[model samples]
Target: MLNFLKKKAALIWAGNHVKKTQDFKLNAEIKQEEQLLMMVRTAEKTLFGRQHHFEDIHSIEDFQERVPVTDYEGLRAFIEKMKKGQRNILWTDTPLYFAKTSGTTSGSKYIPISKEGMPFQLAGAQSALFHYIAKKGNADFVNGKMIFLQGSPELEEVYGIKTGRLSGIVAHHIPSYLQKNRLPSWETNMIDDWEAKVNQIAVETEKENMTLISGIPPWLIMYFEKLIERNGKKITQLFPNLQLIVTGGVNYEPYREKMNELLGGKVDIIQTFPASEGFFAFQDDYLQEGLLLLTNHGIFYEFIPLEEYGKPNASRLTLKDVELHKDYALILTTNSGLWGYSIGDVVRFISKNPHRIMVSGRTKHYTSAFGEHVIAFEVEEALKSTVAELAAQITEFHLAPQVNPTEGLPYHEWFVEFEKEPEDLNLFSLKLDDEMRKRNTYYDDLITGNVLQPLKITRLSRNAFHEYAKAAGKLGGQNKIPRLANDRTIADILSEYKI
Candidate 1:
């Protein structure tokens, strides 16, 4: 009865507020600068704020002129100071914790999550759930347990600031009552070894009333596969009430067909775009075309055209200035005291009315070798189409440019670790190359110009990715395998595992 009442109340709250949330986001262009000004005022006394003279920042123009765009590297000095007992540094209050962003361009990064920032995170989460409930017109999802498949919450302290994966931090911070329907209790969630944790989760959740599952695609697949192995049936058979699946952190195109096959067409999926820097967007539309950006959610956004990034005095456009279908590097000046921080993600706007975006790729994770630039989305679409045509299953793959002068011709080499081998290797390679040409005109032109050879694919034995990640200390939760590389470093490393 209590669970039913809670769920009923939640349904009412979600129904009541979802429209207001959407209305606020629709007016983001009008409110962005005002919100940014308020943020500046709130953080004026912090170390970074005082260093950059936030008092003089009366308008967006003033704020932009005084503060420069930065990534983790640019803020490392201040971060080190904060780690070494500096009070009220980057954030107004000393951060309660830091989220360790894995798979860094340089190295691992620990982003400060202050008390002031917690509300943004929590609110984003609540809104995501509410949006899901409202969009699906169902509040019964909360009546049953939802397995988040989160990272371990055994936080490590760095100079009194607790540090761990973002999912772990969120799990640790969610209210006690909310944990009633959440899977893997604190004792289970604190297991540092991922395999052990997954095994425990598989056993524990097998009999629970699981209606929804959420995690990165790969980990979710692993969990489902484990359940299959343990129960001798599909996951939907085990959890007859399973209705929805939520995914983030990585693209779902490659895994969609296989996951659906595993579930026997028993569930719907909602895609999300979340990061340790902040919760950004989620899919609400029934068609799942693009993510609805959380524009009114305490974070002021800026977009630098991909063509203009790192150039001399590039124009940073706000929500009012951005247009549809152009690739832009994401920049943010959040309420959490991130002043014009570059988030290292590139996105393409799909809609301007309510502001929707699709994450294109990482800023540094693109291939322009031989002047044939290609983004992750194009590559992903190509692979998705090719896999569908060939009826082969792919577990994991990475792309890199092989550009050695002595190698006769430069080519984009794919390191594919397949679940099921293609019938014809040469034909499969041709299909991949053709897909790339079909999606990217520049790549097609380069091929026609004879500046590059055909795309290359080096097939790998099953589970090569797991072995590789294990060797590199990145096998566990929240550690993503780098998908694209400018150089052949990842390619050369994967060469040893070739089938």
Candidate 2:
């Protein structure tokens, strides 16, 4: 009777959430504009708001004019002040919590998480599952265990504000009712080392009737690898009812074949674009070409054309006017007190009716040193095509631009750790190069004209990246290999690494 009630309640909530999301899709444009106005009104008295003359902003153009485009570095002073308990700096009140995430230059970033703003992230989580349940008409997963491979819930005080990996903080805040169906335990999640935690999770969950699994692609793959190794059988053999495999945090294309192979069958894969800054988008339709932009979810968004990026004065557009197919750098003016903030991600709209978008890459996460610009999507797509053709399995990988004066023509360098290395490595590299050249005309022209060297591959002696992560103290919990870098920092470090 209790189980029945729990399942019934979950279905009801899921139904309600699904309907709510549908409503959001209908009024997304007007609703988003209204949200933008509300954020300005509510935060108009705050330091950032007052300084930017938020109260005087009657239009999007005015808002854009008053507030210059800002990145994490640009907002560091205010963030640092917030860490020391400064009130009414960005948001109206002191941040109840601070979400810390890995930074390219700063090592880690502390983002203010307000009480009202926390729900933005939670709404995305619930909506993803609810949409899945509603679309598939399957609620059995609600009764079964959900294994979210995420960070430990443990947090440290960042100048009196609670701070930790966004995953950890979210994990610790999972609603109590849902907690009954989630694993591994808080104790296991608290384990700092990722490898050890995976082993522990495998031991604990190998016997559970898990029906849902959600995580970043690479870590989820690691967990599957450990579970299969420990039980000496397919993951399905251990939990045959597993029906959903939701992933985010990194490109899933290259990892899909291997993850599917581990499951021993094709499981439903849902993509979400949740980040430390905000839970921005989630996959809604069956085609999976784009994610439903959560436009009404207390976040006001803007987009800057990729071509106009880093210009002396680039144009920024609100959702009221974004075109399909053209890449744009995403900007946010959120309920979290972030105003005119560039989260470093780039995306392109695919559907304006429902406001669906595809995350392309980061503004900084591209290689254009030689004018042969290539983004993460291009790299991952190239790798996905090549790896599929070669039947190669990857554990982890990183890429960097190599432009040493004496090292011949500049080339893109790949440091890959393979679970199953390809049969012919040279051909594997060539196929990867060929795929990129096909996707990017500039890259093709550079190579065709002998102005650039072909993309190079260095298959790392196992666990090379892992060892580096451990040494860097990022062994677990939302840590990811930087897929593309502008310089040779990571590549050079790996070059000196021994087997």
lDDT computed for candidate 1: 0.84
Looking at candidate 2, what is the lDDT of residue 452? 81
User: What TM-score, over all chains together, does every model reach?
Assistant: 0.95, 0.95
Model 1 lDDT tens row, 26-102: 78888888889888888888889899998999988898899998888888888888888788677776678888876
Model 2 / residue 61 / CA error / Å = 1.2
